[model samples]
Every structure is written in C-alpha cells, then in structure tokens.
Target: MEPLARRTLLRSGLLVAATAVAGPALLTGCGSGEESPARSDGKPRRGGTLRAAFTGAGAGETLNHFVGGTALDMVRARALHATLGDLDPSAPDGVRYGVLETIEVNGELSAYTLRLRRGLTFSDGSALTARDVLWSLRSPAEDPASLPVYKNPAATFDFAGARVENDHTLVLPTLAPVADGRLLLCQGNYLVVKENSDFSPEVATSGPFRLEEFVPGEGCALVRNEEFTHPELSDAPYLDGLELRSLPDSEARAAALTGGQVDFAHDLSPVTARTLGEDERFTLTSTSPPYVSGLFFRMNLAHEPFRDNRVRTAFKLAADREAMVESVFFGDATVGNDLLSPGFPDYADEIEQRPFDPDRARRLLREAGAEGMRVTLTTGPETPGMVEVATLYVENLVAVGVDATLEELPAGQLFADYPAYTRLPLAASFSVPTPALPLYQMSYGGQNPAALGWDRPDVDELVATARGTSGEESARAGLAAQRALWEEGNTIAPVFKPFTTAHVPGISGVAEDLFEQFPGFSRATLS
Candidate 1:
C-alpha cells in the first residue's frame, strides 16, 4: 500500500501549536500583586529562571529514560530529548509532531513514513537524521535491560522492515496494522537520542533544553537548547534556564510553591489545591475525566479469588467511589464508572455504572464459593492521597465480608521493579489522563508483559481494527473495544482525580501534555 503524499499531510497542518488546542481547566486570578500581574496583553515575556517541583526522586534517576520511571526523570528527559510527537490535552486522540515535519501511514496502516524537518540539529551540533528516529523506536523494545513500561510498546513495531529512504525520511513498518502508530512513537520514553551514542548527560540532545547538571534523587538544572528548531518553542528561550527539584511530600511541595522557593509545583493534595486556588498569587490548573488522575487498583487474575469474574465484579461493587472522592480528594474529583472516564475518545460511557453495593459484593463472593475471602491491598505513597484512598478501599472491602488488609510500601517502591506492582494480588495505583487505547495497550493488551491476567483475544482484535482504520469506523471499533474492557477489566477506578499543578502567575505557555507526568516546561516563561 502506498503512503499518503507528504504535501497532502503537511497541508493538513497536523503539527499545530500545543497550546493552540483545548487544555486543562485553567483557574486564573484577577489580582494586582507584583507576583500576579494582569496579562491583558497576550505576549510571552522571555528570560528568567523557572523553578518547578515534582514527586519521585531517587538514586535510580538516570539520563537513560528507557530505564528511568520517575516523574523527575520524565521532566529531565523532556528538557534533554525530543520525541516524534506528543499528546495534546485539548485533542485527546490527536498527535502533535515535534522533530518530524510530517508522518503519513499507508492505506493499510501497516507502514508509516516519517519525514524530519529540514536542518534539524542536536544540542552538540550533530545532525538529526532518520537513523536516530529508527534507533529511538527500536532500541528500547529490543534491549533486554530497557524498562518494561517502554519495552512493551516498542515490541509491537516491525523494526526489521524499517527503512531509511533518505537523510530525512524513514519508513516504520508495524508488526500489524495499527491506528495509533504515530502516538506510539510519541510515548515519553521513546524520545530520540543520537544513534550509537551512550546514554549520558553530556550526550547531544534535540529538545528545548540541554542537561546542565543532574544529581540523582536530588534535582537537576537545565539550560535552553540554542539549537531547538520548533518555532513555537524556540522563538526565544522563554526562561533563561529551568531548575527542577524533587519534592515528594504534598505538604512540602505546597510549602515550596507558597514560600516562593519554586515557581511551579505538581501533584499537590486536593486540600492544598483548593487553598492555593484561593490565593491570587498562584494559578491552579486541573484536568478531569478521560484524563483521570485518581486512585485505582489492578487485581491480579493469577490469584485464586481474583481468577473468577464474579469475584472481580464483587470488588468493583465494594468500592465506595463517591466516599473516597469526597473524603480523600476533598470533593475535587468526579466519580468514575468501571470504565475509562467519560469524554475520552474510546470511553464507553453508555456502560452501566457499578453502584457501591456491599450486599451485592457479599452475594457475589458467596455465589463464587469464596465467602469471607481474605486479601491484602498493597499500596504506597507514590502519589498524594494514595495511602488514604487505599485505607478507605480496605475499609470498604472489609465491610463486605472480605478480610482486606492494607500493606503500604515506601514511595517509588511500587514501580521500582518492572512488573513488581503486577505481581501482587491487589495493588493501588494512579493514572494521569491518557487516551483509552494507549492506556489499554500498555496495561491490559494481550502482548503486555505486565498484564494483570486480563487477556481477551476478541477485545484485542477490536482494538487492532480500531487502530487500523480512521474516522467513524475507527471510533466505532475503538468504542467496541473499550466496551469489552468496561464489562470485564480488572482495574477498579472509582474516581477521576484531577491532574493538579500550581504555578506562579508569572509563568505562561506551560503546555498541558497528557503524556508527561508534569506539564511541558519547554515553552514556559516568566514575566
């Protein structure tokens, strides 16, 4: 099958400005403080250091993002490496190109042609080429030591058929027809690195900022990448530099933001978000639904009690989602059905919402011949409010004749080892707003190595068909696949917590990226 012409694809201008699209709900203030000046004039004021705080800092941090899983690692990687594309908050299913000028897939959707923008160069003056793109997409999946989170997606591509047609054009053939091939290339860990180069802070980077210094588990400083070619991001170095710090504690992050220690803070507790929302000096932004950032748990089907569908359904019904939201989230989130949040492109909203019925939960357990089931709910302080949510969930489970106890691990321990979280019978987790297909592909897809025992070949086929087609056909197939998940998936998401971040009024142009743990600081500036 012939790929679409480059001219036709470029004419579509799929590579629109990240901020031009619909973004998270921004809560701006009308105040007259030096820190919160009126921005009636919509112009970027370039030149100042932007300090940001995020959770997850550890000795495990590395320049090799394929091996790094922390939020701090992602933020640092964003400043150092560039991906072929990224997810736009406004267009949940859309792909925004980065280094690539255009990507056109063959009619069958089995092959994709990627064209690099002209004259692209890395921070160290190395030319960015199609070979780099091929390597970035292939290495992670093929390397046995790469992080499983990234390895899973890379394993789906047919790298053996990849061909570099020219210095700027690369053909990426998939193992099978895929509808979201472009999005797969844009996964955060798939960032392009120079071909054949060792992973190091000194390696040439093609992103908006170059790594200046990195101290694992501490923080790093970044300087603007003078070679950055993205017009919207490189018109000028918005901030002269960026200083990212690791603040895992919610109270500490809030204090850092309010104490003027940092200009931006991410993953604050709902109570802190509400308090800061009232302060005219800070701007609070949040994303809900299809972009859910909330408490959830994945049940391992390999376990005896969870092996039965009835038992899994019982756990879902046992969760008091509304109570968890009101008590743990301080009424800052929406209740989630068993499926993905509503408004996401593939979300099956018509699916009936599972009510919090403890009696029904007990009946289901009894019918499954598993009455008085005892299980340990493993969780951690990985995100703010997770422990509290887990505790509440345990109480709910216990109320329904299930002997559920809580085992809280240290921060970052849950995901420290790949598939470690999945090994547990039941574990608490959280997810940021991501498109339904990609989320399912990474977590529940048949090929996923870390799948929590929820494997359905029919649902897999539906997802494949959805990705291979476009427009109405694509939406219909995608929805059908999501419907299957809603009916039988093991993950129990009761609330869609907002992805909250607080920034000083002086900061602007922080793009709401659904893929990244933190907002894109590439285009951020300070007045």
Candidate 2:
C-alpha cells in the first residue's frame, strides 16, 4: 500500500466568508430563561469561515481517494466530496441517504442499484456520472496494493461488475451478497473521484469544496464548488471557504481553542473538553468514535511461546483497562469489552469489558507453562493515551513474571507499509467509514491488512453468508457469529472505544450525528 505521511498544522482562524440569512441564535446559561441578546435569530445564516484545529504528527503526500490516513483526510474530504449516505456521528442510526437517491437490497443484496440526483458535479466543473463510480472502483481493483483493504475478503466491493446503467443509475454486482450495503457505500472507502484524474503527488476530488492550497505538513484551504448542488443542506457550508490546520500536540491545540485562535477543534480529551466547556465563547459536544483503538498481538502459532492460548489470556489480564481509561483517557472513553461497537445496531451485547486481574493473568501464564516470554508491544506517536497505557502494560506484565517491551514507531511504519502478521498499522487503526465491514475484513477476511495471519473457515463462512443474505435476521446472525469468532480468537485486545469531542462557539447545526462531524452545515449560522 502507498505510504501517506502525517501532516501537522497550527489551530488558527479556520473560518472564512459567510452569508447569514439572519443573526446568530444567542444561548444563555444552563437553565437560564434569559437568553443571550447577542444570539436571537434561529434562521440559517450564511457566510463565515469554519476553522478547525486537528492534532497529528504530520501530513501525507496524497489526499486522494485511495490514501486513507489522519483526521486531516476526514476534515478535508468532508468539504470535498459528498458520500452516498450521510452518517450523523452524534446519534444512533442517524445516517441519512444523501447523494445516492435510494439503496435497494433485493436479490439477497448480491445486486444493488444506486441512482444519482439529476445534477452532480465535482469541484472542477466535471459532471458526476455512473462512469465515475466505475472508474473509481476499478482504480482500487487495478491496484489493490495501493488500496490496502481490497486484499481483505470483507472488502468485497464489486469493481469488475460496477456498470453505468444510465446517467442516473449505477449497478453493482458483488461476489457475494452483503447485509448492510449502505454501510459500505457511506463509509470512507467509497470516495467518488473523476475518471482519468491524475493522483500523483496530489489528489483531485469531487465535493462541495476544491483543494485550493495544501502545505503538506501545515494545513489546507478549500474553496466553494461553483457547480455543486445539494438541496439537503440549507445554507450549505455557510461559508465561502474552510481551512483545516493541524496542531500536532494536544496542549497546543487546547491552547488555541481557549485563545480563540481557531473557530473549532477536535480530539480534545475529557479534561480539555471540560475546560473548553467552561469558556463562554465555546461549546463542546462528544460522540462515540467510529474507530476502535486496542492492543493487537501477532500470535505466531508455529513460532515460539505464544502457541498456547493461556499466554494470550495472561497478557490480556495483565493490562489494567480501568486504570488506562481513567488516567489516560480521563474517563472520556467507554471500556472496550467487545470487538464490535454499539454504533453497529446489530452488534452483540455480550462482548462485555474484560476486567484486569494480575493474579489471574499470572496464573494463566503459569498454567500455559510459559516462562520468561519476551514480546514486543508496538505503538505509534499518534496513539493518543497510548504512552501511559503502554507503560502500564509493560509494568503489569513484568509484575506477572512476563517479560515485555514497548516498541514505539511512527504510524506509517507500523500500518501502511508492513504486512499484518508481524506489525499492526498503528496510525490507521480505526475501522471507521462504518465499523461493520471494516471490522469484518480486519478480523476474518483474508485480505485485511490487520488480519494478523489468523483465519477460521467457519468465521469466513459466517461473514460470507452474512454478505450474501439480504434478510435482516440472517445477516444479524452472521454478524453475531463474526463477533463471537473475534472474542474466541483473542488476536486483538480491544482496550476502549474513544469519543470524538469538538469545541465550537456561536455556531449552530453542530448536531451529535455519528456518521459525520458537521451535519446540516448548510443550515448552520454563526454570529
């Protein structure tokens, strides 16, 4: 797969020109009947830059459809392309159909038809057609190495049979049926691009904003798409432009937030969230992250030490999850008890949090006849809350008479380049776009970059059956089977489900939607 570098930027004034239909809606103190006179009109106002501060080590080369890295990509892409469906990141089952008119799952979901609205154009004034979809899908198939997930069985997108049925419709022929085809379409994997567009050092995309200027390690600026049209967004974008600045350090990003140097900020911790909440100029909202962060182990069944499941169980018990969540995450994240997140409505409810007990961990190790086992725990710079968590893991494991060392490397080194069995792709750990297929592919699907060289025929069968079955009940059963398989295998240690919190002041339309960070921006207004 291509190596996309991490870009870093300063969190500064990111908002731009706006056209307000009315004045800002003033807010008062909690439960105060007296409203702030500054904000009265609730009408959708247009115009004002929406500057966002993000934290990351650095920036990568391509912002193209294929290069999925960093929060920068998400921020930039949301302004650039509109997906088939809109996932409101704030609430449950809030995903709304957007670009694609309707998704039909008849014929066991083996067949799907996507109908586009009458007029759809890219930022470059190029018309969006079914052909663009075909070209984009085929681009990944033609070069699976460039698109890592294509190698996984769960990444069962049908590029070969993707056809432009007509100007309005595109037909997809999957190898097997999929339960939630909409999940695949709406996720990050299906970003639409113009056919024949060059994706060399830079990427060109079709969205509401065009990438005007991008300084690799600093930030990016986006301008409005003159040819784009979407009635769903009332005052859409509300601004003439948007700027995303990368603030590499959390402290710096937090400082910028309180200084009012930036209009909005993401990835703040619970403490930061609290501090920002106290500010009169800002409001903070938290959402369950689509991504799941955890400790993944490469079990070398054929190699030394780990051939025994007892060793794995011991290692899992040694790590104190509650301590990590409390100290590192500041109680902002949910204890990761299961591989699947609650965001997936069909996800099983039984994957409860595995408690930490050193004695049990040690006993399990002794029972496995494991002694002096030295293993390397690899992590990356972007792994927030990882430093302390890793340290605690190392200490706890040592206390259990197990030898362990924490190996910290850049995210690109671990994930984008290395194969799944030996090292995990740390920076790209999130199974987002939708947690469903991404997790399915990462665990059981052979093509996943994160599969860790482990597979079960039964699990694969379950996933395949689920994909091929259009019935909701059958698909749910398959999902349950898949989740069960993950727990049984113990290949990856799911630590906690992180939360996405943002602090914004005097801004409306920032709903707690699970799919997208900023929803109804078209209907948003700023003072």
Candidate 3:
C-alpha cells in the first residue's frame, strides 16, 4: 500500500473536529476527588519570585492565549485574565469564581445571577463589573481569529447576552439549561477581560497576578495584584513576582530547569520529564490533560486516494496507535479512536479502534486498487511532539508499504494554510479542549480542513441539535450522532492524550488539573 500520491492527496477536502471531550456532568463522576482550597492543609504565604519556562522559549503575541493559542501563553493569561469562574479539573462541572464572588443557578438552570466580589478591582484599581464580562465575551467573539474558534453555545452567555441587574449582580440568560456552562466559561477563549480592554503588556487585571513586563515571542513578568481577594486564594501565590519565559524549544526549557536558570518548566516531553522527575532537586507535577493528539486525515472528497474510502480506511488500519503512543509519547498517552477524548461526557465508548495490522491495511489498499500512493504530512517546526509522532507514522507506513514524506514548516506558516494543508493526506498536529463545543468548532465547524467544500447536513444537524438542547439526554443523543458522523467520515484519526509534565523547585503549591488548561497559580507559594 503506497501512501496516497502527494498530488492525489493534495487534491483536497475539509472537515473540522470542533467538539469538546466531556461535559461537566460526565466529568464530575470520573475526576479525582480532591478537596477544595478551603479543605487543603496548605496555607498561602504571599511574596517571592516565581520564574517558569515554556517548552518554547517565549510567546508570539499579547499574553492572550485565545488569540495566540499556545499553552505556555495560556498559563500567563490564566493568571492575568481570570475566567468568569475557575473550572475545577478535579470536579466534573465545578466552577467557582476567580474574580466574581458567587453565582446563583436557578432551579431550572436556564438563568444565573452572578455577584461580583465586593472589593474586586483590576490591577489599576478599576472596579470589575458586568460590563467587563459583556465586553470580554463580545470583543473576542467579534475578533476575526476568534470567529473560527468561538461558536454560539446556548449554555454560554456568548450569544444570549448578559444583563446587569445591579452593580453586584448580573442576569445571565441562556438558550438552554447548560449544566456545565460554568466550566465552559473557564476556557481560554471565554476569559473575562476588562471592559474596553485590549490585552497588552501595559494592561493589568484582577487576578492574583499582574503583567509587569512582556516581550512577544520571548518572555513575560507578572507581579502580584495586591488587591486580590479570596479566602480560597489566601496568602496565596507566595511568589512576589512570576517570570513567564518561553524557551521556544523543549531542550532549552529542560536545560534551563535542570541548570537552575528557571525554577519551573511546562510541556516537557516524557523523556525530559522522566529525567527531571528523578532529580531530587526538583519536583514533577503531571496531569493527563483532556487534550487529544492525533493524525488528521484530509477529508477532501475531491482528492484522489481520499475520495476512495477504502484508501482512507487502509491508512487508518495500517498506522500503529499503540506503538506511536508508546514510542513517541513515551508510554504516557491513551489511544484515541476519534476526536473525542475519554474525559469528555460525549465520548463514544463503543467506537472500535482499528489496530496496527499492516496485512489488513495492505489488503484494504489492494482491495481499493490503490497500487501506489504518496502523500505529504504538514506540520509546524515548533511542534516538537508532532515531529516525533510524524516520524513514527512514516516508519509504520513504510513498514506497511505506504510511501509517505514529512514536511515541517514554521508554526505561523502551517496555521496560515491549515485547512488546505490537511488535504494533502498529510498528518498535522493539534490539541483542543475536552468539551464537545470547542472540539466541534475547531474541527468541523466553519473553519475546518474541509478546505475544498464540506456540507455534511447530517453532521451539521447533529451538532446543531446538541447546540440547541440543554438537557443531558438530548446532548447525549446529539453527541452520539456527532461521534458516528466523525467515525463514518474518517475526518481525523485519534492518537493520544499527552500528559503535561511540569518541573517545579522551591515551590510549595504546584497543583495541576487534568484539563491542563489553567494553572492554579493563586495558591502557589515559593519555598
């Protein structure tokens, strides 16, 4: 089975995998039963310097992960930009206020009344009000980069709009009773930025940290927000200042951590993590994030080999999932059958995974009359993990008699042609949130790789239906249908959920959630 000819595969299609993995209702039951801050034995102590390193040396734009979409940048964003509430990775749907004080969920769950914390203020002393929430939600929704990602959700106030009942209370109206709306609010996209605020280095916020400095694609420094309040975050963030430096490379970040140039590092590979974890001078905190890592099969029905379903199935069967996970992921990942991660509430447990059987793969290819095919895999230079994953894929495809080549480009260049890029029977890299909402929006939503033309009425209907309903049963049914659509179409191949391994030293509080979306920095205390 030769890989789909580069020209044949490049011929095109587009499909996006935009759904989030698990809803709060489903996750609450599966998460680790960790007690909240009030119950924790550790006490927060203010003030010290906390410098952290990213696998990449730094970030590209404002400390806005939503626009930039880098996990490293997100850590800083979480601290400077608080979400409407905090998504407790430990609790399935538990969303508590990071800046706001409390939220009253009505009996029907269709409406909510959010109360601002009494003395909450932006870093500049501007009082936080409903106006900020409204602006933050609306501004990004209107941003060009965000439209492709943030879709209309009945549960989130994203489209429905919020009404200010008073200075302290906000009337949040929703299309449906979103049991997990609070969790969605904690995502990188939905963060509550200040009203009329542009995320810039000079700006400041109400979170425990305030951005003191930022050098795009380089590093950032955050100092404590003296006005921060919250008993849960008491004495918190022992660090007087936190320096977020992005190294731009895993090797450099690891070296910095080991050499003591940096106190902490994020997104370290399994090998680097293991090495650092063994060192007594440092402590490792790792979480099985709700992110999915996988091979994206370009869905251009217009393309040659891809147009033949048999060819797609053959490649899917030929690739070795377990080997890739074990070899590339360092045995620290779970096999993905499709876009949905097990952590998501909408995940289909019944979906069968095609094992790594080259013979069967060959048979499928032969049956499809695919005598010889070739394809080019497109990925980014900064995607360290993808490079390794692509290498394994190439090796496996070659073993199964498929001819494949790897094309690595800069991160910016890859994303520019993301849609048409995948059409090349190419394997690309992506990590999305656990929710069906975010996942669906990025994959199959309007911006997906179905670059040529994609109009899956059935898929759209399922997603639309899910988006419309608020109840668990309806959501389950819609998600089931959506999952079926993904499986039936072979839009993208599931790979593994990578664990975020962090190395910390002289830090008393460094807890991580499975979502790996936000770092609980408010409670972090430097020893």
**Top-lDDT candidate index:** 1
Q: Candidate 3: where are CA atoms >4 Å away?
A: 1-42, 57-59, 89-93, 102-115, 150-162, 171-179, 289-308, 366-371, 381-384, 398-402, 411-427, 445-455, 463-472, 475-479, 502-504, 512-520
**Distance from true location, Cα of 263 in model 1, Å:** 1.1
Best of the two (2, 3) by TM-score: 2
lDDT for each candidate structure? 0.73, 0.56, 0.58
Shift of residue 358 alpha carbon in model 3, Å: 3.0
Evaluate residue 84 in candidate 3 and report its C-alpha lDDT on the 0 to 100 scale.
Answer: 67
Residue pairs with backbone overlap in model 1: 22-90, 179-467, 291-433
Better of 2 and 3 by lDDT: 3
Count of backbone collisions within predicted model 1: 3
lDDT of the structure predicted as candidate 1: 0.73
| Alpha carbon lDDT at 431, candidate 3 | 55
Q: Compared with the true structure, what per-residue lDDT tens digits does model 1 show for residues 1-527?
A: 01233223222221121121233322232321255333467767766678787776456666787766666777777777876777654444466777887788888877888999888899989899999988887778777656666765555577788899998999888878887876666654467789976887678998888877666665677778889887345475566788777666666666666655567888777877887888878788876555556578888888988888899999999999989989988888888886654666567676678899999999999999888888999988777788888899899999988888999877666777765666899977777555677667776777465667888889988887887777888888888887777667788888777778887776777754335355667677677
**Model 3 over residues 406-496: C-alpha lDDT tens digits?**
7877543455433445455554655555566545544565534433344465676566566556677656756676665555565555466
lDDT tens string, model 2, 260-313? 555666666555566667766566665554444443344444445655667766
